[model samples]
Target: MRHDASRRRFLTIALVTAATAPIALRAASAEAAAPAALPKLPATDAAAKALAYTENAAAVKHAAFKAGSSCTNCNFFKGAKGQAYGPCTLFPKNTVAAKGWCSAWAKKL
Candidate 1:
């Protein structure tokens, strides 16, 4: 009876570990493979300069810039609503501040 109980307990442990091992391994691999966050676009970048991009919309002086405009409200901005910084269509590889502005700013609607 004692030997039978030991064998059953060992078998149960081995089965449980085998069932959960793949799931644990997959979760670890996915975490490791996750991409890092994108870099922020600098206001001084050549492309940014051409568009008159500014980190703060209030400081924009371009003729095309309108009062109360910013990346959060622009058509080219792809950031989620309320995000402080996010990716922009114009600067594909970099994120922009939600309050940033540029000549290309257009109504999201």
Candidate 2:
């Protein structure tokens, strides 16, 4: 009875591991294969002006623009690995320039 219990426990562990291993591996690979970073948005875009966006944060003219803040360092930036442009939560379906700045920029935690 002892041997039977041990064998059953081992089989259960093995089955569970086998079932979950593929899922774990697939998730890892999917992360590795994600799309490259998006293109930088034009500073002249209407939306850019509305948000007081600037390719260079230091160049922003808005009274609320902070001198040292930039999109690359903002919480809203979702840049991909090694790229200068990425999607911003503030601008759905549009990319923000990495060096850009906006009034909505928030320091990434």
Candidate 3:
């Protein structure tokens, strides 16, 4: 009709920009391959020496340290309560220190 409706609206905008250009270049290469922070947990790693991890919960002396246990109140701290460092479902991809301590400290219920 009008040159076949302008060639079917330019082939439906070139088939929706070739079906969304590989999901917008894979979401901009996953936000430029993430990792801008996460990287602290290093008290000699190996799972921070099998959970004796201490970034200074009053310099833990073990015995499953308790007097006000840390990692910003444990339960595998994910950070935010006055964060001095964060993430720690037991150091996945690092970051811990909010006055850390480990022996898998729980009690964040």
Candidate 4:
């Protein structure tokens, strides 16, 4: 009877360890794969500005930030080819156009 109890306890511990082993490994892998630094945005030269979305009147200005373009048309928009963010001369520091807006929008020039 004592042997049976010992075996049951061992099995319980082993089962718990087995279940948690995968979880621990997964967490380690995820942390390892995590980016070392903040992800970068695309370049903003003349070529990047070609995809700007501010020309569309329907596009709204970025909230909170009074100077940058909105995500819809900003040069850094991350949507589809047309829907993605484009480059803007306004926000030189921020790669994603998800920030501010301005009237200086050019037609890719």
User: Which digits, one per residue and each the tens of the lDDT, describe model 4 over residues 1-109?
Assistant: 9999999999999999999999999999999997443232444445335434233334544343333335554443433455234433444434444432334443221
Give the runs in model 3 whose Cα sits over 4 Å from its true position.
1-6, 18-26, 36-40, 44-52, 55-73, 76-86, 89-100, 103-109
* Regions of candidate 1 where Cα sits further than 4 Å from its true position: 1-34
Q: Which candidate is the best by lDDT?
A: 1
Residue-level lDDT for 13 in candidate 2 = 100
**Alpha carbon lDDT at 52, candidate 1:** 86
lDDT of 2 by residue, 1-109 (tens): 9999999999999999999999999999999999775456776778877888877776778888777888888999987756677899987657877888988888899
Backbone clashes in candidate 2 total 0
TM-score of each: 0.67, 0.59, 0.35, 0.47
Query: Which lDDT value does model 3 have at 51?
Result: 83
- Candidate 1 residue lDDT tens string, 34-75: 878999998678999898888899887788988899999999
Over 52-87, each residue of candidate 3 has an lDDT whose tens digit, in order, gives 898889978889788998989888898898989999
Best of the two (1, 2) by lDDT: 1
lDDT of each: 0.92, 0.83, 0.88, 0.49
| TM-score, model 1 to reference | 0.67
TM-score of 3: 0.35
| Candidate RMSDs in order | 3.8, 4.8, 8.8, 9.9
